[model samples]
Target: MGEWSPDTELDGYEQLVFLLPEEPTYALEPENSLVATLVRHDAPRYPSALLYLHGWKDYFFQTHLADEIDGPGYDFYALDLAATAARCGLSSSPATSRT
Candidate 1:
C-alpha cells in the first residue's frame, strides 16, 4: 500500500494507491496488476461512517456530499474503482470483477 497523500482533486480528502496481483490478460505479462485508489475524508464529526461508491466511468469528486454526511456525526469515504482517478495511469483496462 502506498502512503496516504492529500487529494488535490478533492478538498478535505486524502487518497492512497495500492496494487494487487491478478491474472494476466497477455502472455508476455505473467501477472496483471490491479491498481486501487482509496479516498477518505479526514476529521469526522463522529465515530459513525458512510461509504460512497461512484458508478461506471465515474470517480469520487463529490465534496458536498461528504460534507453533508460528515455533518451528521459520521465519517465519509469513497472507493475509486480501478483505472479511475489516482489509479488512472496505472492501468488501461477496466476491472472485470467487483469483489
Candidate 2:
C-alpha cells in the first residue's frame, strides 16, 4: 500500500510498517538493528495516521495492540529506534581518533 499522510483522516484498522535506520549511529554500524512501523486506516477521501515509537530493545510484536485498535476502519502504527550499545547489550563502536 502507498504511504499515508499524517494529516489524512483514517477510517478503520489498516496500517503500514516502515523500517528506519539511525543517521548518526549508522556510521558506527552497530551489530543490532532498529526498525519502525507506521500504521493507519487509509481512505481515498479521509485518511488517519498513528505513529508509535519503541525503544531499541523493545519491538512492536504485540498483536493484541493491533487487535484492540482493530475496528471497522481504524488504524495503528509502531516504530522502533536504534538504541545505544548500553541498551542493546552490545559492544559500542569506538570512535577513531585522528592525530
Candidate 3:
C-alpha cells in the first residue's frame, strides 16, 4: 500500500444496493439500491484511488485505508465483493459477478 501524502480531503465509496426494473421488451436490467460511505479524512486534496478485490470469506470493513486514501493527492477504496455477497465470483447476476 502506498502513502496518500497530506492534501487529500473528500474520500468515500459508493455501493450499489438495489436494482431498477426494466421493460419486458428490454434485454437487461439495472440495480435499484445502493449504500455509500463518506470516508473520514483529515487532509484536503486526495486525488488518487485504489480499489481492492475481496477474496472468499472477506468483506470490506477497514478504516485504515481511509487514512492512506485521505492524503494530499490520493484516495483508496477496499471492496470485499465475495464476502459482502453483493458482487463477486462466477455469477451472472451482476449483483455479485465480475469478469
Using lDDT as the measure, the top candidate is 1
Candidate 1 residue 4 Cα shift, in angstroms, is 1.4
| Of 1 and 2, the candidate ranking higher by lDDT | 1
Q: Which 10-residue window of candidate 3 scores lowest in summed lDDT?
A: 17-26
Can you give the TM-score per candidate against the true fold? 0.66, 0.42, 0.36
Tens-digit lDDT string for candidate 2 (4-97)? 4442123453434332334344454553333233433334322554455664554345656655665533455654343432236321222110
Off by over 4 Å in 1: 23-32, 43-45, 83-99
lDDT tens digits by residue: candidate 3, 5-29: 3212223433332222331212232
Per-residue lDDT, model 1, residue 16, is: 69
Lowest summed lDDT across 10 adjacent residues in model 2 is found at 90-99
lDDT values for all models: 0.60, 0.39, 0.36
- Model 1: lDDT of residue 80: 68
* Per-residue accuracy of model 1 over 4-81 as CA lDDT, tens digit each: 777646677787656645523344433545556667886445767888876345567788888898776888888766
TM-score of 1: 0.66
The alpha-carbon lDDT assigned to residue 13 of candidate 1 equals: 74
lDDT of 3: 0.36
